[model samples]
Target: TLLEGVEEKIEDITNKLYVVLAALIKGNRANCSNFAQSARLNWLVNRLQSQQASSGALEVLHSVLVDSPEVLNMITEAHILAIIGLLDRNGRDPKVLDVLCSLCVNNGVAVRANQNLICENILQRRDLLLQTALVDHVTW
Candidate 1:
């Protein structure tokens, strides 16, 4: 069984397993330091940085980012802020944006603070303002 195989490979599964275990135990209140110190996080970021060369890698990362609670918790507030800032400046993929918004909501983080700023930025782009207003009002 997969559980038995995983048990056999326990030592080789990587620190992400421990980080995930901690998050599962503590939920949204999980300590951020474990994520910050994780080698697995570094590996994930490196993999994302190189994703342009391989679309399959991007899909894998999108899956991890969207589906893994541990991976979601591993995202620091600084990283979230940066991504929101980038979305404000350059727009964003709707699917990815939805995933991010959902993650923020699920993690019990206040998405309103930066989400408002991003909406305002989008509004500055002419006809998009109305759409932004509608989304903001609904989400709020």
Candidate 2:
């Protein structure tokens, strides 16, 4: 059966799906966070970290979170902070900085309005990013 075939090839299917989903997210063609998360992006990140595929995985995650213009209003403050923290820790990657800037400029208002406490909690982090020499290279 077609479903059986798909199930049997879950890993291949998921990898292909990730490619498509990553493209969509990078192109800003999808606005649904649920769809993005459904792709197991976080799981992919963990897998990448485990396998030392950090660069590729971070690239996909950055595209989904930053390049995707679809602002996920439902994302929790903690979640946003977590992404920021990850970027801060591994932000030496150029792509990570790009995504961080987008979140700061594009999603900043919604984040501040919805989760003032969380926003405040990460103020130092934000400020540090701003102070970084790389900050100038990130536009919007």
Instruction: Please give each candidate's TM-score.
Output: 0.37, 0.46
* Candidate topping TM-score: 2
For candidate 2, what is the TM-score? 0.46
Over 4 Å off, model 1: 1-37, 43-59, 105-140
lDDT per residue (tens digit) for residues 1-140 in model 1 = 99978754653353445345444534333433344344765654454343322223223334444444466656655444444443444355453465356545544656564466555554565442234343445443
Q: For each candidate, what is the lDDT?
A: 0.46, 0.53
Task: Give the Cα RMSD of candidate 1.
Answer: 12.0
Report backbone clashes per prediction: 0, 0
Query: Could you tell me how far off, in angstroms, the CA of residue 132 lies in candidate 2 after the best superposition?
Result: 9.7
Best by lDDT: 2
